[model samples]
Each structure stands twice: as structure tokens, then as C-alpha cells.
Target chain A: MNTELKLQALLDGALDAREIREIEAILAQDIQSAALMQELKWMKAAVAGNEAEVKLPETREFYWSKIERGIAAEAKQAAAAPAERAWWLRFIYPATGLAAMVAVMFVVSGGRTTDGADTESVPEDVNAISFRSEAEAMSVVYVADENGTFNPVGQETKNEPEADK
Target chain B: MPQPPDFTTTLDVQLVAFSQAGDMIAFEELVARHRDKIYARAFSMMRNEEDAIDLSQEAWVKAWQRLKQFQGDSSFATWMTRIVINLCLDQLRRQKRTRAESIEQLDEELGGVERQMPVVASNPTEGLERAELRKRIDKAMTQLSYEHRTVLILHEFEEMEYKQIAKVMNCSIGTVMSRLFYARRRLASLLQSLKKEQQS
Candidate 1:
């Protein structure tokens, strides 16, 4: 710190013994520093205990009324917070269940079929073609022997009459 | 409901305890006690009656909401003062952003302006009555920038140490000291000028 601020610290009683001695020594030697220190002391003394008395203009009841209203508003807001959160939770619970159901269905079906359309697959060594329809819930399979003659081996239809089961 | 307990005779600490227990009557008593000091602190910082009143009211509401957190480290009045001071600082910062600072104010904030000011050799406040001294000080305070005025109010009026002022003002200790030095010097100069104006 410079001499001026050191003088200030001295006036505020902020300086330790060593710093006080140092500032005192400076004060004895420098007229300007001493003068500045004196001015600071005067200002401090004048300002202390001299704050202008100010009163809240409103009556006690009037002022307290506003504070009461503010507290009520804040309390209301705090209470509403949990209900606001529950509103979001209402959507979240069903959305979570729907997601879990979709996950399970994907696992059970092995994979998803596009557009619920019929799908046909032929295995490499079986020499057979299989047809499946997710929408109709039906399956048909045709097998071919060494002569390449195709014959129906299995057929299942969800819409078939019970006598045809 | 049964008649509410009499709070007129209750001490501040008891009132605070009751307030903590969700007693609005006790909290109201606390407000009735220290409302002036709190409003004064805000006005001294904000320099506007409307803002001071509004902020002081806001401080009370905040105090009530946060009463559970009051640990009684400081006197209830002091704690309330701190709340109001913080609120005023926030309001001042917001106001500062929307306004332009004068060149003199900028110089004051940047430091070294007090050096150019010549020292007032005679004590400007010497032989003044208590009320007159207060009036002069208040007038002189109005002449300072908010930063300078705030530092003075914090250091001198609030009786806060340099470190405490730094913490409250959200600045470095060096900045606090520098601002304080400038404020004191400028205040001396202004008081001297007021004295001369009166003499003439």
C-alpha cells in the first residue's frame, strides 16, 4: 500500500503495531501524508453515528400488509410447485409403461415387420419357402424334393373355420 | 382461535424463535421494530424513497421465507440490514447496467482521482452540531458515485471492516480499500466546499 492508503488504514485502526509505527514515522516526516490522515479521521468521525434517520413512509399496518401479501404469494407458489411437477409425472408414468410394452413386443417378435405385410423366406439347405403375415396371423410352407416337385407341407390360417383345424 | 400471545414485550430473539415456528405475529413484531433501520439502509444506498420502500418490504418477505436459516450469528437487526443491503446492491447493479456513467465517475472507479484532490487542511466538521454534521455528511454523500457512496456507507456507517465490505460489495479487498480512500478524500473535499458556501 502507498503512503495515503497506509495513512487511511492507520486512521481506521486497521494497521498492526509494526504498520502503525511505520505510518507514524511517515506521518512525522511528511506533512501531506499527515494532513491527509487528519482529513480521513475527520470524515470518519463525522460519518459515524450521523446517518440520516429515515422512516418507512407507510403506516405499520400498511407496510406489514404488503409483506404479508408477498409471503402469501410466495407460499402459494411453493405449494403449486409440487402439483406442477405431478402434472408432468402424469404423462411420464403412462409414457414409461408404453415404452416398456413396446420393448417387450419387439423382443417377442424377434424383429418388427414393415407395414404389417406378408414376408417370405427360403432357407439355404431346406429347399423350402415359408410365408408369414403379421396382420393376418397366418403361415404357409412348401417343400421341394430332389426332383424339384413342390408340395405343401404345413398351412395355418387364423381366420380358418374350427372344422378345418 | 385462542387469543394470540402478546408480542409487545417479547425480546427480538424470542420473536425470531417464534417467527421460526411459523408465527406471523412474531415476525410482524420483528418488522415493526427494525423496519426503519432497514429502510434507511436501502434508501442510503438507493437514494430513492420508492425503491427503498419497495426493497425494504421485499427484504422483509425474504427474511420471513428464510427465517428458518437464520442461525443467530449476528443480531437480528444486523442480519436484516445485510438482507436489505444485498437487495439494494442487486438493484443498484441492475440500474447501473442501464445507465451511462459520467467521466468523473469513471475516473473515480478507476482510482487515482483522489490524489488530484488537494487535502483539506482544516477539519471541515470541526465545531459542527451533531445534526448539522449529519446533514452535511448526507449532502456530501449525495455527491459521490454509487460505488464511492456505497463504500463509505459500508465502511463508516455500517461499521464493517475492509474485508467484510469487500465480501458484501463483491470486490477485492484492495478495491474496497481504494474506493474507501477515494470516498473519504472526496467527502472531505465536498464538506469543505459546503463549509465555504455557507460562510459566503
Candidate 2:
């Protein structure tokens, strides 16, 4: 191969020592060869240039901790998963049951009716009344308490009428 | 006196065996052993130290997760290096997907701006010390595109075969050869130009 092709291959280590030496001799025979050789040598060095020292980054403990924890988790998973993991599931069920019970009690006990339904807080059995919607299709007829009154929306009675008196 | 065993060699076999058997500590030791080399390889490819470090760590996590597949066909370090290279390539491919590079348009290699480099008739490294030479070369290397820079690092520093570089780069061996060729040429021109500037 010509010097141009040989130069690249030589730097590539594709050309053996004998080929390199022969090229060196040929170049020694010509001045222009010397310029070409210089370019080739510099090119080789610049590419094959000694590498900068590679510094290993200092490791963070947090990174190691992640690996440690992940492995520990796997270890725990292997050793006794049903015991530890089941606790979380088991706790969820009972806690959910307690919350559901509280919700049910809140609905059934009718604790402290705040919507002015309490003005007539007379326990339903004592002075039972059913109020009907004006549509009557939804009868909410507050069966009139024998006391003769029920305020469904909780408006106050200002005064008794003469007829009632 | 009995010769001491090569600790790294011994440790590598032991760790690989332990890790294959599902020992997490053994895998961690392997990570610590090879992290720097893998990190450097990724950094060289990506040219972004932070991303390189992250990807290298991700590669380790993956390697540990997939330790079962390692058949021990190669040296552990070589196997690990392969993993890191694959991760870096995946990251590059992801970036390539988001980039606007048209393969058809980019195939044409321009002679490029370095071709017009001013004359540098003198030897740049003639009298400079090795440290200075390395510094200048590193600066020149930084000027190369990621594609070109990766080929040069793999070829020169890693001493990887062209076929191996092609695999790492996900390109044909011909592409590897061409990139190395052009990269070396541009670097030669750049360095000599830098040298000329230093001298004058």
C-alpha cells in the first residue's frame, strides 16, 4: 500500500513492524516523505495520546445504603415474608372494620341532628311525625304529633293562631 | 514463600458464584470492584459525567438483577463492561430517537471546518512534557462529536477490536472504521493547529 494508506493502518496497529520499517526506509528516501511522516506521527500520537488518569468517583454512603436496604428487603422477603407483610394486610382489615363500624353508628344513632331537625328532637316514638314532600309522590307526612305540630325544615312557630287557641 | 493469589481474580470468581446463587453482598462487592471502569466507559461515551454515573449504576443494578443469565463464558469484568456499554448505547438510542438527525442526510461525511485549519508547519509536542501533551490531546478530543469521540476512545484507550466497537456503537464495522479514521484525522489537524498556536 502507498504511504497514505499505510500510515493509517500503521497507527491502527494493523501494519506489522516489518511493514512500518519498510515505510520508514521509503520515507527516508524523500523530503516530502519526511513531512508526511511527521504528520503521520503527530496524528498517531494525538489519537493514541496517553489517556488522562481516570479518577474513580468517591462513592456515597446513601448509594450503598440503597443497595443494602434492597438486598435486606430481599433477604426479609426470602426468610419470613408471610409474617411481616401479613401484618400490614391484617392491620388494614381490622382498622377498616373499626372505621366502618363508626360510620354505621353515626348513621344509626342519629347523633345531634344539626340541620334544625333537632328542634323537634322529640324521639320519633314519643312524638312521631312523617313529613311528606309537596310533590306528595314523596310522602314525608310528619304524622302530626298529638301536640299538633312538626317543623320539617325547622322554621320556628311565631305564635299560635286563635283557631288553635 | 508461596505466591499470594491474585485477590481480584479470586474475588471475581467467588463473587460471580455467590451472586449467581443469589447472594446480594457478593453482587455489591462486584459493583464496587468494577464501578470505576464502568463509570469511566459510560462517561467517555456520554461525555456527561452525571448521566454516565447514573447509567453505570443502573447497569450494575440490572446486572445484579439478571445475574442468573451470566453463564461465565467470559471474564467477569469483560461481562460487566459489556453490560455498561449496552446501557450507554441504550441511552444514546433514546437520545437519537428524540433528535432530528436524518440518517439519510447525516450519512454524508463533510470534510468539515477543521479542514480549513490554519497552517501548523511545526511539531506541537516537540518540546512539551507528557502531561502537557495529554492535556492538549484531551482538549482536542473534547472537540469531537460524541460518535467520533466514542470510536476513538474505544479503539485507542480500550484497545477494543473494530467488531467490538461496532457492537458497542450499534453500527456496522465499516462505520466504526470510518468514524475512527475521520476522528483521527480531525484530531491530528486540531492538535497540530493547537501546537502551532502554542509555539507562536
Candidate 3:
């Protein structure tokens, strides 16, 4: 250790026997270090003997009242936090379950024939023909009008008047 | 629940257990029991009464929050003390951020000009009564920089070892030793000056 650290260790009684002997020999040879040792010893003794014991200036009740206020406030916040979370969860839990149920119903009931019949054969006089396009992944519904022409529900036929005109 | 023994006479461990179980009364008792020591520790580090009081109370609030985490490794007071010390350190750090840097602070970091002075030969406290000595020490403590005062308080007043102080201060053992060495030397110098002032 360096000289200052060695001296500190010596004062702290932290030195092993060999280090203690070394420091002692140095102290005997060095007047400055010896004086430092004397000063440090006196200082340590005085401080250890007379460390101040200060009490809080406020009355005990007054001081504790502040802490009690703090605790109460924190406890209230703590209690309120869980309640607020539970309120949100009350709404969120059913919403999430509803979404899951809708997804499951969609998965179970999607794209199935309701009756036990082949879907390819159209009824002889049926006016609406629904076409499923496998490549584009879309279903198109076409209705046959009085002229026996099929028209997609949303698209205008040739005889329709343009609204903007 | 066996009517929960009077909190005033309850031991710290019992009080802590009750506190963990959400008993505010037990925590209030703990606060009353150790408030002075905790406040004194904060005051020793912060050297400001308001800051000490705030920090000590904050430490108690923290203890209440973390009561369940108290695994009985150390005494509740010691654990509480560590919390207060941490708060004081954080308070000091915040204050330090706004503090102006000065040549004097630099000098203190480098052990100051006092490190070169001839060592005082006589015991400065030799002729004083115990009460007077304590008063003088308290006055001298106020004059020290936070780092020096903190190391002295930890070593002398708190009776902490260098390693423990190092851990608390979050510095190396060598830094603790150097700080303690400088603190003692500075305390000795201050006491000598105080003695002279008294004589004059």
C-alpha cells in the first residue's frame, strides 16, 4: 500500500502483523508520520467519544404525522391502482373473449354448404348466380334481370342512367 | 390473530412482520422507535435539517413499500439505515449536479493544501469537556465537504469498516481509505482551529 493508505490502515487497525511492523518501523524513523499518527489517534478518540446525538427538532407526533401522511397517501395510491386496473380489465376481458368467440365462429362456420346438396347445380329458374373464384379468393354474386342478362350487384348495367350526368 | 401485542412493546421483527401483513400501526411504531437514529444518519450525511427530515421520512415510506422484501438478513433498523443513507446519497448527488465547481473543491479532491502541513502534535480535544467536545465536533463537521464529512461519519460515528464504507459509498476500498485519511486529517486541523478560537 501507499504511505497514506498504510497510515490509514494502521489507524483503522486493519493492518496484518507484517504490515503493522513495517508501518511501525516507518513511524519510528519518520517524525512527520509519527506526528500524523498522534494527530489521527487524538482525532479518532475525540470523534468516537463525542459523536453528536441530535434529535429531530420537531415533536415526535408532528414528525411521525408527516410519515403517517406519506404512508396513507402511498397506501391509497396502491389500493387505487389495482382497482383502476380491475375496472379496465372488466371491460377488456369480455371484449377479448368476444373477439375470440367471433374468430372461432368464423373459423367453424365459414364457406360451408348449409344443406346436404351439391352447390354446382343451379336451380332452373334461379335469377341469382353466385360464383366463387378460387384464384382471386373472392365470391361474386350475379343477378339475372328481365332481359336474361346477368349483372354484378354493384356494377351498373348498360341501360342504367349515369347519376353524375 | 391473538389481538396483536401492543405495538409499542413489540420487537422490530414482529413489527416488521405486522407491517408486511399491511398493518400501518406497526409501521408507525417502527417509525417512532428509530426515527431519531435514521434522521441523525441523514443529517450527518446531508448536513441539512430539512433534507434530513425529508429523506428519513422517505426512507420509512420506502421501508413500508418493501417490507415484504425484508428477508431478515439484517436488523430492520440497519436495513432502514441503509435506505436512508441511499436517499441521502441521492439527495447529495442531485445537489451536486447544480453545485458550482470551484478550485477549493478541486483542492479537496487532491487532499488540499492541508495534506502538506506539518501534523499537529497535541490532542485538540485534551482540555474540553465531553459536551463541549461534541459541540465542537458538530461544528467542524458542518464545515467539511460532503464527501469528507460522509466518510468521517461512516467510519467514526457509524463505526463502519472501510470495506463496508466502500460498498455503501460505491467506491473502491482505496478510495474509502484515502477519503477517511483526509477526513481525519481535516477534522484534526479543524479541531485545532476550534481550540485556538476557544482559547482566544
- The prediction achieving the highest TM-score against the true structure is 1
Ten residues in a row with the worst lDDT in model 3 chain B? B109-118
lDDT at A102, model 2: 91
Segments in model 2 whose C-alpha atoms lie over 4 Å from true places: A1-6, A15-38, A46-49, A66-165, B1-10, B100-122
lDDT of 3 by residue, A31-103 (tens): 8888888888888888995778889888878988888899889989998998789988989989999999988
- Candidate 1: pairs in clash: none
Residue range B1-200, candidate 3, lDDT tens digits = 57755777788898888889988888888888899999999988888899999999899988888888999998988889889988898889789889896887778877645677668888889978889999999999888788889888888877889899999888888878877887788888888898888889
DockQ-sorted candidate list, best first? 1, 3, 2
What are the candidates' individual DockQ scores?
Answer: 0.61, 0.17, 0.51
Number of backbone-clashing residue pairs for each candidate, in the order shown? 0, 11, 0
For residues B111-199, write the lDDT of model 2, one tens digit per residue.
23333444345666677788888888888888777778877888888778878898878788767766766676677777878877976
Best by the lDDT measure: 1
Instruction: Tell me the deviation in Å of residue A27 in model 2.
Output: 6.4
TM-score of chain A of each: 0.53, 0.28, 0.48
lDDT of 1 by residue, A105-147 (tens): 9999898656758888887777888788777767777889789
Give fnat of each prediction, in order: 0.92, 0.32, 0.86
- Model 3 root-mean-square deviation: 10.9
